[model samples]
Target: MRYASITERLASLGSEKWAVHVEARRRKGQGEPIIELTIGEPDLPPHQSLLEEATRAMHAGRYRYSNGRGEPPVVEALVRKYARRRPDVTSANVLCFPGTQTALFAVMLGLVEKGDAVLVGDPLYATYEGVIRATGAEQVTVPLRPEHGFHMQADDLERSITPQSRVLLLNTPHNPTGAVLTADEIAAIGEVCRRHDLWIVCDEVYEELVFSGSFASPFDDPELAERTIVCSSISKSHAAPGFRSGWAIGPAEFASRLLAVSETMLFGVQPFIADMTAYALDNPIDTSARMRQSYKSRADQVIAGLADAPGLTPVAPEAGMFIVVDVSATGMDGEAFAWALLDEEQVAVMPGSAFGSGGDDFIRISLTVPDEMIDEACRRVSALAMRSGVRKELRA
Candidate 1:
């Protein structure tokens, strides 16, 4: 039997056990207890106001088709929502999507041409490189190392830029590294991007999830404003990932073209969710402080529990719901440690390699799990590492 080839188009494909583990547990058909430190999903429910508003809209029979570009009132609300920092921003700057993931891909589709290259931070969100790859563009990298607090530096970026490079994809409160760019870091990046004439697509999905450090967007600089495209979602901030509502804020023309490309690509996000999403922006959810504090506590505990574990060093994070543990000292690479722990102790976590090249020696721990699960997962990881003589010696 002849079949179409999926190989060429999806060349960069690799297995990520996080989603696999999630489904595997569900298929057990009953009480299989799996400690999931894999996915970034929050255990918290959606905001009370958002839930009530969505329910009312659903009951009112607002299920009819919405404008493919997005409903006007929601777009207007989004304009006002972001106007504080971007005081000049109007509805022209906003384009809504079902999820930031889709908006991200749309930005590439609208901007990237075949054979063009995108510069991405190494050890970025696992899906970023995949998105850039799907656009028939090559994804280049500038390493974000622990010695540099995992922050991406302008010098490294300048060195990596090539003639084919057309875009730089950045994430703050970075997914695997949790390195939030400071205001100064933002400026350095902006200077380079402008000098190189590169399009800047900055993802601020964890904008409000910062703990030790503050966040500053590339769009904060007026000079970089025209070149910057900002992507964010209500999923992380509002603890409503299921809603799949995300948006892009950029120059009006690009926003409109992006809306056209995206709506044509996926018909714009679900209209119901889009409506409730707008209502969310208008009503606002104040879960920032609580989320930050709880994630910080969980991050602290993850490190403390692994204190006596061999070859493990905690990379202190400034923001975001995840912290990467340097498993280099454990004499085990990330994949080896991750799979061994999962097999031996039933604790599931993502191998750093799942993100990009610089992640080979690390593993990411999610703060979305309950406190007891956090304790248990960390304990199991530490116990496995204890079998190493170095861990025993360090304990003594």
Candidate 2:
């Protein structure tokens, strides 16, 4: 028997959180229920209108291959929705894909050639490096310091750009860190990218999840808008991860190239799914105010809980459904601490080191669970610290 050699590019990338979750599930079998706070999966149900729209589309026999670019109605609806937020983009600039992950992959594949370099934030979405690796592009990470609230420094990003650098991946209200970029930060990044003549790929999946202030996108600037590809999805906003619907909005030229790549990669997104997503976008099930309130409540609970725990101090999350808790005061590496908590208390959380080097002494917890679960998980985690004699190290 012969097997093809696995690509060298994927050799160094491994998701510790996923591996541990899978192993834990395998050991528990089907009987024991694991309280999952590791992955960023929303527990809420998707919009009922989305389900109704899907059912209607199925009844109407609309489950065929869609236009490679996406169904016209769906694209038009996306254009209108985005126009309300970003007036510069039109329907012609949008290309629908199965999900934001796929859209990201398509954009990277279309723009990055072999040996090209791309800049990313440290402790970023773990998959960014993997996607860049798959394209044979080198990933240079710019550190987002905890002291600075995980904000990306424009100077650091600019310094990382070399002649081979072609792309800058920016995730605002960033994953793991939950730090939203300020308007000034966005403008600085825009200026740097413009000066470097680098394309900006802004991942704004958590745009609507912001708690304290307005979400700023690099696309807000006319100069940056032309060079920016905004990739987003309904997974975070509408709790519709299973729907697998997302879009990439950019210049018409870039959209055309991305459409070509998406068509060849996945043929076309399911027409019924596209239609359902369009319907949901048109009539949001939960008002944005209600959703934001719920998330804010959860964020507050998690932050307060962490504050009470010994040797654990979590930065207040500005947006998104995650909080990164610093565990350096406990004098233990994040991976070891995460596994110890899981084994001793049966609470599952992602080790921050899985994200990047900047996350080495922290752990990331998702706020997707209920209030009671969040309380219980925090109690269990705090118990571990008390047992280890680290409870006195917490800062007052």
Candidate 3:
């Protein structure tokens, strides 16, 4: 039995959260009332307009293979999106993809050749290093210090770049940590990228879901405008992950290459999905108000609940919808704690180490669950902490 050598690459990139989540699902099948907060799935309905537009397109027989690059409407919609804030980019700068996850890889693969380095933030989204490795590029990480509210600093990037570094990957409204980089930070970072001659890739997937304040991007920075590539998805804003609607916007030359790669890789997204996504982006919704209201309420509940927890401290997020709790005092690594909590209390959360070793002493909790569910999960988390012998102290 001969297997492909490329299959070895898969081992470098499996999500540990899914293994724990599957077990939680199995327990639920056996009648356990488990609360699974391991994945960043928003428990909300997709927008009515998105649904209607997709249905309209499908029924109107607009379901054929796309123009082999992008449905014109979808590409143009992405253009108008950037135009609202980044008038520098025209329709030629947009490249549509099946999903933002693929766009992440496509940009790296399309731009940086093997042996070049892709610099990223420590404790980043789990797949980042894997994607870099698969592209045969070295993944260099700049530390995002807890002292700095887990935000990526420009000085850090300035010091980390070596001669081989070719790309700088930035995630605003970051995953796992939930930290949003400010406009000043973006500009400063872009200055560093410009000085060092690095291609900047900003993953703004959660751009529209910022809970506390407005979002900004370096793509809007004129200094780095030519060197920056911004990739995002309709999945988060529309609450329609299954639609597989995503795109990349960069310089005209790079965007053309990115589209060529995207077409060679996935041959463009389904026309109906792209049409729905275009409609969602063109006729934007004030979903930020809705997200801010719901997520803040839920985040406040989690933060308040963890205040009484024995050995955990929930870091208050500035924007994105996750609470990363420092659990070093628990005398257990995040993976051990997450499994124990799931087995003993039927509550599922992601082990922070899966994000990176920087998160080994922490755990990430999503605010996607209902208020009551988070209450129960936090109660279980507090109980787990108490087992480390702080029960009497915490109760008192």
In candidate 2 the C-alpha lDDT for residue 158 amounts to 80
Candidate 3 has which clashing residue pairs, if any?
none
Arranged by TM-score, best first? 3, 2, 1
Better of 1 and 2 by TM-score: 2
Q: Write the per-residue lDDT of candidate 1 for residues 115-139, one digit (tens) a residue.
A: 8999999988988876787788888
Residue 183 CA displacement from its true place in model 1, Å: 1.1
Question: After superposing candidate 3, which stretches have Cα over 4 Å from the reference?
Answer: 1-6, 284-286, 390-396
Instruction: List TM-score per model, in order.
Output: 0.93, 0.94, 0.95
Q: Is candidate 2 or candidate 3 better by TM-score?
A: 3
Clash list (residue pairs), candidate 2 = none
Candidate 3 residue-wise lDDT, 48-75, digit = tens: 8778888999999987877546888898
Worst 10-residue lDDT window, candidate 3: 387-396
lDDT of 1: 0.82
Of 1 and 3, the candidate ahead on TM-score is 3
User: Each prediction's Cα lDDT score?
Assistant: 0.82, 0.82, 0.83
Tell me how candidate 2 scores on lDDT.
Answer: 0.82
